[model samples]
Structure formats: structure tokens, C-alpha cells
Target: MAKKVVTIKNLEYEYPDGTSALKGINLDIFEGESVALIGLNGAGKSTLLLHLNGILQSDEGDVEVLGMKVAENIREIRGKVGVVFQDPDDQLFMPTVFDDVAFGPINMGFSEEKVKEKVRMALERVNMSGHEKRAPHHMSLGEKKRVSIATVLSMEPEILILDEPTSNVDPRARRNLIELLNGLDITKIMATHDLELVSETCDRAIVMFEGKIAANGDVEEVLTDSKLLESHGLEAPVLVRLFRDVMNREYIPIRLEDVIEKPNKYKI
Candidate 1:
């Protein structure tokens, strides 16, 4: 079995204004598992994600990442769990792409030579090589997103957390991002509404509803259940819904490649 990378038990959190963001959330994320946290706008997906790396601490419950308590070892845990926020601007504050990517390693006390090597490798991983000196502010949204991911990659985190990674990017950029994420080998917790990206990258699906976990299972099973998805203010991927509604097919196809492999098998 895969070793558990993160564990949350009876976790609950509330904002200063008495807004309950997470309630009784229990989750276990294993090493190397790409899990998608899916929910509506206020379903508390982001709230739960914040607890994973100690950004938000629950008063009533506990959270542990990489075998250390988030509350006590937050400084250490933050280095292990790299988070890329929804907006690239939130993550890319350094002047240039190289600076932004090197910040994480530098903060970890890496030597100048090591930091430079890390930045180069991370940029290459995200296919943003040769843009080191470019200012992030001048880059397009897609480019900014890639650089944002590279910043986290420089940390060489054991777990990668991304919030709405595909949001606001063009189709080609989205596709490339999906491919890039798929190539990475790490535990990933992605909170996103993009079912297409979820299907492409995650093997497990976690659906949150009103500050609690409504459903958790294999990506295909949870995403293919139109009733469960609709009840949670979500809809299945377009291809999955089409197979169910129009073709009246019993099995839902989540990826384009699956449909293309045997189009006649799904004939209406």
C-alpha cells in the first residue's frame, strides 16, 4: 500500500466572521496519488486544502502531513507541501521567472549553485526553459501559470497542491498544463472545478458539499454518477454526460482517447 502522506481527522475550521469553512472533514491522501477535490463555489474545497500544509489550523481536530503535525511543524511541513494558488500573481511576486522559481530553494537554505540548478530543472520540467530573465508581469496568463508551477517545483516537494490550476487559461495552455501535471511524480491534491482536467490528471475524486465530504471514490465512478454530481452542484464531464444522456450508454467515457479508441462501441 502507498504510505499516507497526509491525514485529517474530524477537522473543522471557521473564519473570524463565524463562517464555517470546513466541518468534520476526514481525509487520507497517499503518496503519489493524484486526488481532485471537487465542489461548488462554497463547498469548502479550498478550506480543506489550506489545512493540509498548515495555512489554516483547525481548532477542534488534527491534521498531519508527512508524519508531522501541521500545527507544530508547519515550517517544516510547508517545505514538503508546495502550494500553487489559484492566481499566478499570488505565487509569482519575484521580479523574474528565475527569481520566482529560485525563491523556494533559496529559502530552504540551498547553496547558490544548488538553487540555480533547481531553478533550471524546475523551469525545464514545466517547459518554461530559456525564459529565466523574463519578468513574470509581462508574460501571458498561461505562461504565468506555468512559471507559478515551476516555482513550487523548485522546492522539490513531496506533495503538490494546486487550486484551480486550469482556470482562465486558453484551451491549448490547459491541455499542455494537463500533460505537464501528468508527467510529474508526486502526491497531488488539486482543488478544481475543471472536470476535464480532473479526469486527465487525477485517479481519485473527492466531492465536498457544504463544508463536509459528500463523496469519495475512484475518479471514474464518482464523475460518472450524474445524479451524485448534479446533487452536489456539479455535472459530469461532457463526454460522460453525453454517453449517459444521448447514447444511453451504461459506461461513461471520461477521456477523449477512450472515445476515440472505439467510437462505434458507443454509437447511439
Candidate 2:
């Protein structure tokens, strides 16, 4: 059986102003799973993510990372779960890419030589090799996003958490980012409105609505449910809509490759 890297049970949280963000949430994320948290604005997706690494303490329940309680093992948990924020600029504050990537390892007490090696491997994983000296502020948005990922990668976390990872990138950048995400083997959890990205890279889909889990199932099953998606302010992927609505076919294709594999099967 796969290991459960993250486990949340009856989780609840409220903002300082008494705005409830998460309510009675329960979830288990297993090792090597790529899960997508999909929800409309104010639906508690980000709030739930904050609890994963101890960024926010739960008000009413338990959150465990790799068998340790988040509330009591914050420092240790932080080292194993890396979070990449929605905005790359929020993560890349150092003057150069090298500094940003090396910050985590340096703080973790790695030697200078080890930090350099970590930074190099992390950057290479993100395809950002040989640009260490470049200032983050001067790089393109896509490059900055890669650097932001490298910052967390340098830590060698067991799980990777991302928020709106493809939020502001162009088509080429988005494609590259998708490829990079698919290549990673660690457990991943991402909160994103990009259904297309979910269709391509995620194994499971979780729909969050009003601080509760509305749906949790395989990516294809969840994405094919147009009514379920529509009720929660989400739309099915373009291919799903095309095959189910326009083409009037009962079979839904969530990814482009599905259609490409059997064009005649989906023909009108």
C-alpha cells in the first residue's frame, strides 16, 4: 500500500475576523499522488493548504504530515513539505536565483558545498540551469516561476504544494510548467482553477465548496461531470465539453491525447 504522507481529520479554521475558511474537512494524500484542489474564490482551498505545513494552525482538528502532528512538529514538517505560493514574486525575494534557491538548504544547515550541489540539482530539475547569477526581478515571469519551484526543490521535500502555479505564464511557459510537474515523482497537491492543467497532470481531483469537500475522485471522472463542475463555478476541460456537449458523445475526453489516440471513436 502507498504511504499516507498527509492526513487531515475533521479540520476547521477561521480567520481573525471570524470568517470560517475550513469546516470539518477530512482528507488523506498518499505518496506519489498528484492531487488538484479545485474551487472558486473564497472556497477554502488556500486555507486548507496553509494547514498542511503549519503555516496556519487548525482551530478544531488534526493535521499530520508524514506521521507527525503539524501543531507540535512544525519545524520538522516545514522541512519535508515545500509550498510554492501563487505568485512567484512572493517566493523569489533574493537578489539572484542562486540566493533564492540556496536559502532553504543554507537555513537547513547544509555545508556550503552541499548547498551549491542542492541548488544545482534543483535548478536542473526545473530546467533553469546555468542562470544562477541572474536577478529574479529581471527574469521573465515563467523563469521566475521555475526559480520559485527550485527554491523549494532545493530542500528535497517529501511532498510539494503549489498554488496557482500557472497563473500568469504564456502558452509556452504553461506547457513547460506542465511538463515539469508531470516529471516530478513526489506527492503533489495544488490549488488551481486551471482545469486544463488538472486534466493533464493530476491523478485525482478534489472539489472544494464553501469550506467543505464537494467531490473527490479520479481526474477523468470529476472533470467529466459537467453539472458537478458547473454547480461549483467550474467548467469542464475544453475537450470534455467538446466531446460531451458539441460532439454530443457520451464518452468524454479530458486530455488531448485521449482524442488523438482514437479520433474516429469521437467523430460526429
Candidate 3:
């Protein structure tokens, strides 16, 4: 059995202005699972991701990551779980790409050589190598986003969480990001409304509505349910809907890889 990397039980959160952001959210993310959180703009997805790394404290429930309670082991939890925010600007504050990527490992008390190795490995993972001297503010949004992810990857966290990763990127950048995310070997949780990204990169989907999970299951199953998705301010990915409704197909293949690899099997 896969170990549970993240567990949230009856999680609830409220803003300082008395706005409820999350209500009774219970979820368990197993090791190496790529899960997507899909919902509308105000659906608490960002708030939930914040709780995973101890950025936002829950008002009424608990979150555990890698068998460690977030409240009690916050420092350690932050080190073990990395969160990439929706906007790359929010994460990339260092002067250069190298500094941004090396910041985490350096703060973790790693030696200079170890930090350099981790930075190199992380940048390489994101395909941002050879851009170490580039200033973050001068890079394009897509490049900034990649460097931001590399910053977190340098920490070698057990869990990787991202918000709106595909937003504001070009088509090629989005494709590159999908491929990069798909190749990662750690548990990944992404909060996004980009159904295409979800279909291509994630194995499971969690639909949030009014701060609660409306649906949680296999990505294909959840995404194919147009009724459930529509009710929660979402829609099936274009490919899924195309095959299911227009192509008169019975079996829906959500992932691009699956659709391309088994085209004959999906025919009605």
C-alpha cells in the first residue's frame, strides 16, 4: 500500500474578515500521486494549498504531511513540503535565477557545494539550466515560473504543491510544463481550473465547490462527468468532450498519451 503523504481531516478555515474559505475538507493524498484540484476562482483551492505547507493555519481541523502534524512540526513540515504560488512573482524575489533556486537549500544549512549541486539539479529538472545569471524580473513569465518551481525543487521536498501553474504561459511553455510535471517522481498537488493540464498531467481530480469537495476520483471519471463539473463551475476538457459528444465515442480517454496510444480502443 502506498503511504499517505498528506492527510486533511475536517479542515476548516476562515479569513480575518469572517469569510469562510474552507469547510470540513477531508482528503488523503498517497505517495507519488499527482492530484489536481479543480474549481472556480473563489473555491478555496489556494487556501487549501497554503495549509499543506503551514502558510495558513486551519481554524478547526488538522493537516498532516508525511506523518508529521503541521501545527507541531511546522518548520520541518515547511522543509518537507514545497508550494509554488499562482504568480511566479510571488515566489521569485531573488536577484538572479541561481540565487532564487539556491535560497531554500542554503537556508536549510546545506554547504555551498551541496547548494550548488541541488541548484544545478533543480534548474536542470525544469530545463532552466544555463540561465543562472539571468535576472528573474527580466525573464518571461514562463521562464520565471520554471525558475520558481526550480527554487522549490532545490529543497527536495517530499510533496510538491502548485497553484495555477499553467496560467499566463504560451502554448509551448504550457506543453513543456505538462511534460516536466508528468516526469516528476514525487507527490504533486496542483490547484487549477485548466482542465487540459489536469487531463494530461494528473491521475486524480478533486473538485471543490463553496469550500468543500464536490467530487474526488480518477481524473477521467471526474472529468467525464459533465454534470458534476458544470455544477461546480468547471467543464470537461476539450478532448474528453469532443470524443464523448461529438465523436459519438463511448470510452473517454482524458490523457493525451492515452488518447494517442490507444486511439483504436476508444472508438465506439
Question: Evaluated with lDDT, which candidate comes out highest?
Answer: 2
The stretch of ten residues in a row with the least summed lDDT in candidate 3 is: 259-268
What is the C-alpha lDDT profile of model 2 across 176-208, one tens digit per residue? 999999999999999999999999999999999
Candidate 1 residue-wise lDDT at 116: 96
Report the C-alpha lDDT of model 3 over 3-41, residue by residue, as the tens digit: 998999999999999999999999999999999999999
Q: What is each predicted model's overall lDDT from 0 to 1?
A: 0.92, 0.94, 0.92
Of 1 and 2, the candidate ahead on lDDT is 2
Clash totals for all candidate models: 0, 0, 0
Off by over 4 Å in 3: none
Candidate 1 per-residue lDDT over residues 1-268, each given as its tens digit: 8899988999988999999988898989999999999999989998888888888887789899999999999889999899989999998988889999998899889999999999999999999999999999999999999999999999999999999999999999998899999999999999999998998899999999999999999999998988999998898888887888887896678988877897776653
TM-score for candidate 1, please give it: 0.97
Worst 10 residues of 2 by lDDT: 259-268
1 versus 2: better TM-score goes to = 2
